[model samples]
Target: MTNALVIGASGGIGTALAAALEGQGRAVTRLSRADGLDLRDPDATGRALDALDGPFERILLATGILAPSGRSPEKSLARIDAAAMAEVLAVNTIGTALVLRALPRLLARDGAGKVGVLTARVGSIGDNRLGGWHAYRASKAAANMLIRGAAIELARSHKGVTCVALHPGTVATDFTAGYPAHAKHGPEQAARALLDVLDGLGPDESGGFFDYAGRPVPW
Candidate 1:
């Protein structure tokens, strides 16, 4: 039986992704703060995964933050706040690294296993024409580096492992509620698209960053 894992299961994209996988006949394991897997707390994260049995063929780390609550994305370098930036990095990058620390046990070794770390297109260094959201951008960019490094390390040991950073675009969620975007996808639509993208990736593309459309994003 195919099993899947979604770390931020309570969030919009995470919920949709988990449901979509279940609809595809996978037994989905959902973990969130309700499950005591708080990314902000390293001990909680370790304890939560320790309780799970895995080698899940699909694993999605869907947790991310645009900024800390009561704060909007920074409009200029002057707007960068130390505490808010730290919080963003805590959830998006460092926390993600901590999660990948369990990769050797959580992902399948004998067959194809895929891990998608949700990031953003704005995180791209080469694609940056308009600049703002300093902390969010830096956090995701750092997260992508972690994904690349993880993918490379896993490739030397784990067969058929494809771990990559994914850009879900802008989805209609509280995460994007106040953020005005010219284009936004519904959670379900984004889930299906992201799944499709993941399905098409292979070991050769493991460390690359890609959009929901499966096009490689410039790092």
Candidate 2:
């Protein structure tokens, strides 16, 4: 049976994605902070990944943080708090980096394996119009860069691995509970759409960013 792994399996999008993958009859393995896979802790993250037996056909990381708890994303340069920014970057960018280090071996080296790194259009430097949420935006942008770089290197070593960034759109989750107006999609719908997007990608499309509609997001 084909196997898949989701790194942020406890989060809103992560749970839905796992269920969807299972519905497709794929053997799914899950890891998250709730299951002792804290991406923020490198050693813990490394240990969790080390336990996994891989050659997975698909690997997705739904990990991210919009901002620290009890605080909103900064709307202006004057409002950017150093500590809050650090926390955002820690979860959204740096933690993912640690997880990424193990991915080269976890995925199929010969068969065409697909990787989806959850990111956002807000992370797109070319799509930025409002220019707020400095830290969250910057962290995601960096994550995109990381994925792009990974795609380039993986194409060389793991020729069949297609790695790219994904934007799930405005899903109604705890993360967006505050902005009720933008809560247009349920997590399940978003997950299915993202999976479809992943299904359509090829090596030529790797290192690109795409939205749930399977359209490329300007980088």
Candidate 3:
């Protein structure tokens, strides 16, 4: 049986992805802040993940926050807040790095092992036509770099391991509740789309960023 681990299993997309994986007959291990696996605490995150023995074929780090509590994505440079930006980075960038750093030993060493870190199109510097959401955008951009760097290093030792960043597009989850005007996919739809992209990925495409539709997103 295929084994998978989902780090942010409580959120809408995360929950849907976990369920979808299970539905496909993959045994999935889920961890989340609700389960006391707070990504903000690296030691705790390490311990929690260490408890699991792997050879997991797939690991998805689907945790991210658009804004800190009592805050929103900045609409202008004047709206930027250092504290809020820090919070955004804590969850989106730093949290992702922590989870990714734990991967080498957890993934299948002899065969295909896929790791997908959920990022956003806004994170793409070359694709950012409209400017706004400074913190969230910047944090995800940092995450993309980290994913790429980690993928390169992992390939040197684990040739079968593939790590890539994924953009889920606009999803109709509470995460996007603040911007209802944008078209969004339901969590289930987004989950399926993302999994399809992951399923299609070959080692040759590792370390790249792609959208739900499997199109490469410019950095």
The C-alpha lDDT values of all candidates are 0.92, 0.91, 0.91
Q: Residues 18-58, candidate 3, lDDT per residue (tens digit)? A: 99999889999999886678777878888888887797998
Please, what is the TM-score per model?
Answer: 0.98, 0.98, 0.97
lDDT against true structure, model 1 = 0.92
Residue 23 shift from truth in candidate 2, angstroms: 0.7
Model 2 per-residue lDDT at 16: 98
Worst 10 residues of 1 by lDDT: 174-183
**Stretches of model 3 off by over 4 angstroms after superposition:** none
Any residue pairs clashing in model 2, and if so which? none
Could you tally the backbone clashes for each prediction?
0, 0, 0
Question: Which runs of model 2 end up more than 4 angstroms from their true locations?
Answer: none
TM-score of 2: 0.98
